[model samples]
Target chain A: MRRYVFFILMIALGIVIGIFYAQEINPVEIVDAPPNTLRADYQADYILMVAEIYALDRDPAQAARQIALLGSDPPADIVNRAIVFALEQGYAPNDLILLRDLSEIMRTWNPNLQLEPGGGN
Target chain B: MSLPLRPWYLLTGLLIGVVLGVLYAWVITPNEVLETSPAMLRSDFKSDYRALIALAYQSSADLGRAEARLALLEDEDPARALAVQAQLTLGEEGGTRIAQALGQLAAAIQAHREAPDDPIIASLQAGVQSPSQATSTATVPPPVVRTATADPAGQPTATTTPSGDAENGGNPTPTITPTGLPTATATPGAPFVLLDIVLECNPNIDPPRIQVYVTDAAGSPVPGVAAVVSWDGNSNRFVTGLKPAFGLGYADFDMDPALSYSLRLEGGGEPVDNITGRVCEDAPEPYWGSWRFNFVQP
Candidate 1:
């Protein structure tokens, strides 16, 4: 029984060392991160871009879909967060207007919007 | 004849340790990557990012800003990559709008490359340089500020050998053909006239094609000419030199059977009408034929 216990202790020690080495000494690099991991400033820029497109196409649905990609936050709040970030980062005035316009759209936008191709025709 | 079983348990423990180490390293508590740029996005997310950039370009028409945004992708030949993505999107359901936006952006970039001094592009550039807009442009990190031009100082010249399409004669050459010459050889007012039109029955190019080639009066291959093909009240726009394997002056549009189409250079001369695909019975498997139209500045 003592011999068996000694072997088990050795195995347990190995596991702890293995975890420490992996966690501290040689960690794996996570290169391919999703868009949700984008830095706050880049995410804000991305939101600004979506706003710019919404202004041009006036397709609130597409705009909503794009903003929704930045995690599960409400689309309106996502744009608002971006607006706050853009303000803090000293983004240009025209760019801010674009972001604000997108915010207004998202605030009143439908989450279940779907396109019916050539529907009115 | 006893096998050496004394330290076997130690060896087993070490083996288990290594496996656990690998799992711990790769799966559990993996290294967190922070402050990742757009270039670090996974492949599918990168595609979405690119499509959004194209949509924004379609809206703003700010060619410089669009070019800078594309540069973040770090593509060797942004034009060819955009063209390839446009092709990929063409096959996706409901990808027409995205594909059109990509093609339009590529065409606009090419146009700006060929004729940087065009009054329209110049005015847009002026808008892009507004102090407010300029501040946001400067906000991009250093590496992301790359130009889409074929050759930037101290950067490798872009070589366009985008995957050869089975329809485009499966022979793709490693053509370092200038994707961006930055040389303004365009006589903005010079209209491209019809040089020749040849209709062919090659079964290899199926689903029919309208190959349009535009050249200068000196007969040099002129790339980046916008060709608009309209059929039955529907029109599509594509740019030349997108596929370097075909020729620098080459651009083509897919054709549906029996539809009369008109081809014209956007902002240029008269439209060539009565352009239609034909049925070629030359091969045992009869396929629709294609038309090749050549235009040159007279």
Candidate 2:
């Protein structure tokens, strides 16, 4: 009878320890994006696309090409403006495409887009 | 089962366990945390006070540099003059970073100020500034200035559109008296204005509110009338509640993570808007806690 009672006490202690271990939580384990990560601008699409391309490989011309494909409606300085915007955003080619649709929408908007006319060694 | 059970053993065991657990918690726990409370509070206060003081120093330094740069331009340096103007604008905008640092430091200090006078806390406060209440505060008076009287009442009044030394009204040859005060003087041939905004917060107190100080083209404080502070996140505009303004301007808002922010000041019959230039968001959470900044007029 005494042995059975001791066994029950050991089991109860184990359960309490297990519960405490399971319940422990880290307060700082939140996965939220840093502030000002995204901007709401017409050229942001080009910037995002350029970042994706740059991250994969360093190709300013290819990035420029991707930017030129943004939308059918052309802002006067569209390609050059996009290039500058992309550079400012520090878009690398490998960056994950967080806003793919936004890029696609921009491409559909600028149909006559072409690589900025002036670039080479 | 029917026998009388006093259960004395169970009660005694529970009491002993509780007492032992408390003793272990008090003695075995890290002493660093226990000893750090007072020093930590004092350090926090000093940090906050340092923000305001550092800002005061930076502004004074920038003002001096600007005046010197402008004075050099008068000796025929047009290119240098343009560079000076750009530098001044950068310096003016940079005031925000200083202000924010000061706000955090001040909040920490206020916490120490309100804590009970434990010897450790008292010693910490004393190590920073004397702990005695009598030494905490020492009052001083504003400087006296003598001016020629036009009106029989002899009340000094500032005239609008002051220029060409005529504003002094025959009180020519102004004397420079430095009594450890911040002053902004506009030199001839290179006029400039600096607006400083001071924000104060006491987390120990109720809801944290930021105070905005509004000054004129001169460093002199602008009083009366209210200014409205509006931001991009909130729909309603936050109007300043206090008056005569202290340094530049003040507005309070709950801290948020968004880096780019816009501030608009509309009051005293004029409206000015500004955008923050490249906020440093990727910093230690502590550094990014709270920010105080100033908006200078264009």
Candidate 3:
């Protein structure tokens, strides 16, 4: 009778232990948003690009004038769109800088490339 | 001779095994906990504080480098490093940012500094020798200082109208002689209020790291805190001797903006407490605390 009682207690302890193990909780993971979701960082990049283009302008006044003439004299928006297209093709910041420099050189040396601002908005 | 293995021998072996097992499990086990001590907790806190300070130092250095880079671009490398160092020591974010931009301006000054034989920046530096150049200028409205009084409660209080500079108020008779360029003339007509600040620490600075954040009524950052900072990390005393800068309601000392830090709201008259995060990159929010502080207002 004692042996039988001992066997029953052993089984009961095993069941309790199993229940506790089964109820164990796992840790949760916290994931941050992807880079594309960071709109502010992206905006900062775009603004930096715009500033770079202006930086290539000869003087502050001349740069301002050149930007203003984009629609009527030479379309800066079109240039920006072309740059954007290049970006879609995986152009980086440094590449954009080179492209901007090339555009400035063209505006200064290659008169033929300059477009009327009214041609494109 | 063996007469086979005896039952007694088997029982003896089993008894020895049981005794040994009990001893290993209870008396001699390496995993057994003897006692707990508070020293371990103190050590951990100290270690955390050190880690935070190290992180802040690294961040501050990076910011200084970035600022110095701007000056390198401008060609003013020597003064660039000084400005960067001052910004770090000043422990003000706005001042640090300004120092960064001025680093670029230093590059412009470099053209002068590089030519050891010629002194170009020497003249420009002399030309720009005004506190106004280092600080911002806000048109002080009149009668504000006269109306200003300390708040009975400890919160920041303001005067309605400014009292002009004590030396010259309202209209002053000018005695000016210009040498080609614009002369330095006192604007006695304009009324202005000066914000002279004094900072005090109540208790000892036990926790080495503390972050201070000052905000305006609208919760926007108040700039120009560095120009008026005074704190001794070692003495942990009430620090005085603050100089006002040429800017709106902003000043700071004993804090570097380059590092990430958090301010914990503590009870009345207690110095502000701060926990530092990593520097250079955006600090992970809900900072890791290593130190505490107690700021007494003067």
Model 3 TM-score is 0.19
lDDT of 1 by residue, B54-104 (tens): 888667655556666777677787767777887688668888678766765
- Global CA lDDT computed for model 2: 0.31
Q: Give each prediction's root-mean-square deviation over alpha carbons.
A: 13.3, 26.8, 26.0
| lDDT of model 2 at position A104 | 37
Q: Pick the candidate with the highest TM-score.
A: 1
Question: Better model by DockQ, 1 or 2?
Answer: 1
Q: Is model 1 an incorrect, acceptable, medium or high docking prediction? A: acceptable
DockQ, per model, reads: 0.30, 0.01, 0.01
CAPRI category for model 2: incorrect
Cα DockQ of the candidate 3 complex: 0.01
TM-score winner between candidates 2 and 3: 2
- Off by more than 4 A, model 1: A1-34, A112-121, B1-21, B31-42, B91-96, B108-209, B213-250, B253-298
Question: Considering every candidate listed, which one attains the maximal lDDT?
Answer: 1
Residues A15-76, candidate 3, lDDT per residue (tens digit)? 44433333332211212222112122222222222334344323323233333322343534
Best to worst by lDDT, what's the order?
A: 1, 2, 3
Model 3 lDDT at residue B3:
33
Quote fnat for model 3: 0.00
